[model samples]
Target: MPIDTTPNAAIQRSLRQCLSNAAFMLYQQGHVLETITIPFRGLDGSALRQLREASREWPACQQVLESSEAAVYNEHGRFVLTAMGRELLFDMFGQGAADCA
Candidate 1:
């Protein structure tokens, strides 16, 4: 199914249902998967995290930039924003993650 980026609740629901069913079918086939937030362009977590605490959610949230290089964090509950994300926030709001309350 085609994706509708418009802010329509019905369209969003349909897209979500489609994705959910696909994932469920995969799980039923014994191919379970977990969600992992990743950096844009598959950047290095070390390089990106240094720009900010990119592993803020490292404990509870799974973040994977590359399967070859992974940072194992033993904590959670904090939020992290990638360098690109920080730049976007700065460009959009004149505020980086550090400036946010």
Candidate 2:
């Protein structure tokens, strides 16, 4: 069967919110991107699929996340952000050096 690739505003909003929340948590906890997980919150199947799709389309998401065999084993993969991902997050979110430090 063909997949439905149509964009859903609500899903986009939810996904963006999820990423933003994750970014904030990373900042607050002072956890480096390598230690942080994208899609940090538990999501329903549909939302998880959406998150995966968003990661593909967004550079920041792509840089920050990667899918691994571990995800399949865990039933929910935890993606660690790369150094570039951390830099991109701070840049996109306007977080200052002090904020991260």
Candidate 3:
């Protein structure tokens, strides 16, 4: 499969903005990205909009995000991290992303 290697500053910023909503420490099964969605408060409007725009073209965004291994909301409506996402989260926060959880 072809990968979108082009730099997507918008998506990257959106991903970072989404991550800002919740605190972090480390990642377990679904720690880092999961925190963005809670029963009471889900992703903020801006973050959601950003994601929507980034994901407007599913295949395109998939290639782009997957290339960078970013955390994304899958078609199943679940937030999942790619390989880079895990590493990125760990780099940003150590141990577990449960500080605010």
Using TM-score as the measure, which candidate wins? 3
Q: Which residues of candidate 2, in runs, are more than 4 Å off?
A: 1-7, 34-78, 81-101
Show where candidate 1 strays beyond 4 Å: 1-7, 35-101
* Predicted candidate 2 versus true structure: per-residue lDDT over 1-101, tens digit per residue: 87555665554444445456555554454454334423343333554455456444333443324331111112455444444444445555655532242
lDDT of 3 by residue, 19-86 (tens): 44323221321234544333232344455445555444433443454455564565555445544555
- Per lDDT, the best of the predicted structures is 3
Show the lowest summed lDDT stretch of 10 residues, model 1.
65-74
TM-score of each: 0.26, 0.32, 0.33
Higher lDDT: candidate 1 or 2? 2
**Candidate 2: residue 46 Cα off by (Å):** 26
- Ordering by lDDT: 3, 2, 1
lDDT for model 1 comes to 0.33
> Comparing 1 and 3 by TM-score, which wins?
3
Q: For every candidate structure, what is the RMSD over all alpha carbons to the true structure, in angstroms? A: 14.9, 12.1, 10.4
lDDT of 3 at 65: 46
Pull out the clashing pairs in model 1: none
Cα lDDT of model 1 by residue, 3-43, tens digit? 66675665434433433342343345343222112222222
